[model samples]
Target: MKRLRRVDRTQFQKLTYPHLEFLYNMALKYCGNTYDAEDVLQETMYRAYRNFHQLRDEAKCKPWLFAILRTTFLREQRSLKKRPLLDDGSGYLKHVVDQDRKSLGALLEEKMDKANVQQLLEMMPEKHKSPLILYYMEDMTYREIADLLDIPIGTVMSRLARAKKQMKKNLLKKLGMHKKKRNFSIISVFLPGGGL
Candidate 1:
């Protein structure tokens, strides 16, 4: 590993450390578990440290960190492709409670549950989920999201639109509220009260 000089380390810390919480939350959403989120965060930090010299603009640090986090998550997912799903023993009860929570009509509280929201994200396709998470969780602009994901701005908008649609569908289905196909503006699932 390349060692960071004192000056470089300080500058890197100044630019990056403040965003650790943001990174951690994003990682948690991406990994869907604390353990894997921690692993992803560690890997992201190590990679950032090693490649700190490559950063061209300090103002772009947040988006740069996001890029690293997103790539690291995609890599982790690829590596775990063959891993079998282990039953966590939280059987139908968990689903029942989740449904109840949704039906309670407190949109903010129901959406604020991290685990529940993360579970919903995990059910989404990665393409849609990426933009959905970036836009909703990070408050990133479509341009920024496009750059981070290496896709066009239009693509980001479309993915977000589709992501929102798919999330509403999935959420309604989970809450046993899906009756017919209609355009419902249920964006609260992605945005709790204001942000994640």
Candidate 2:
């Protein structure tokens, strides 16, 4: 019994120790926060430790770990008692905008002057943005993205279509094309002795 436990421990350490940081970063990108990603990583590692025997091939370790992490995150999100609204309270807004400006300078120079589309991308919902990012940013094939997200290929296509539409709307509004209407109520006060 002790020998089996020792072998399991060795395998877990050998499989996960080197890839922990990579897995954490990937999880963080999906989870969109440091603390949540950290928790997800920990839970994923724990599960991997318990289910180490289920891994069929050691060569498929990276994808397997990522799948576990992704599943763990999704499960946590579903089980939340009250999901909190996404906000830019952690200075991530500034950081993301700055990085976008620096990295996309060529696009800015060619297309327009100083357009921060990346920050706008950050404001988009995870469901919409995830497929788009995985498709365009990461250069993954639709099939690969579908596999990674555990969704049908058609669903991935639909989500990408809807996501592009939303992105267009958001960009237009941000550029001041579709201004939001403001409602104002005016009250009149009548003074003694009306004008003669």
Candidate 3:
């Protein structure tokens, strides 16, 4: 690996290091384990360090690093010849809880707590889950997701839409059954203007 220049090291440590947690979380979501995610993160940093000189725009560092990380993880998965890891239910549930805790309070978290959502999401093919995770978890725009995934923006939007619909259907089925047993009414409110 080429040694990072003082300025490059400073910039990476200052700007990129802060995002390590975000990267790790995304990696964990992708790989479905802390160990694999850490491996991917470490490999990503190593690749980033080696190829830092090739990065043309400093402002694109975040997305660029993520792309590299995704590529590396995919390559690693292929090498291992293991089935693509799915959400283990617990990990994704913890992630959802953590996200809810961060953005919404515990009360809202309780209301939003649907363990089946994670399992349903995991059941989705990577084509759907990847874009959904990138768009929702990484807060990436469709265009950004396209760039990272090396696909067109329309594809990302379409896959996201389908993924969301599938998730909703699965959640509804699971919750409906649960409510039926408990003798509770399940009401679904669709916004007048929302499509998909």
Best by TM-score: 1
All candidates in order of lDDT, best leading? 1, 2, 3
- Which ranges of candidate 2 are over 4 A from the true structure? 81-196
lDDT of 3 by residue, 1-196 (tens): 3554877887767767877988998897687446678999999999988888787887887898899999999999787665444577675522222322121112212334445445766778899989877766566778899999999999998997787666555656766653344422221221111233
Off by over 4 Å in 1: 1-4, 82-196
| Residue 178 displacement (Å), model 3 | 6.4
lDDT of 2 by residue, 90-123 (tens): 8452222222212222322223344465665776
lDDT of 2 at 177: 56
- For candidate 1, write residues 1-196 as lDDT tens digits: 2454878889989999999999999997776446778999999999999999999999999999999999998998886665555555874222222321232223434345766777778899999988887776666778999999999999998998787677777777776668955544454433433221
lDDT of each: 0.75, 0.68, 0.67
lDDT of 3: 0.67
What lDDT is reached at residue 156 by model 3?
Answer: 96
TM per prediction: 0.44, 0.43, 0.42
Candidates 1 and 3 compared by lDDT, better number: 1
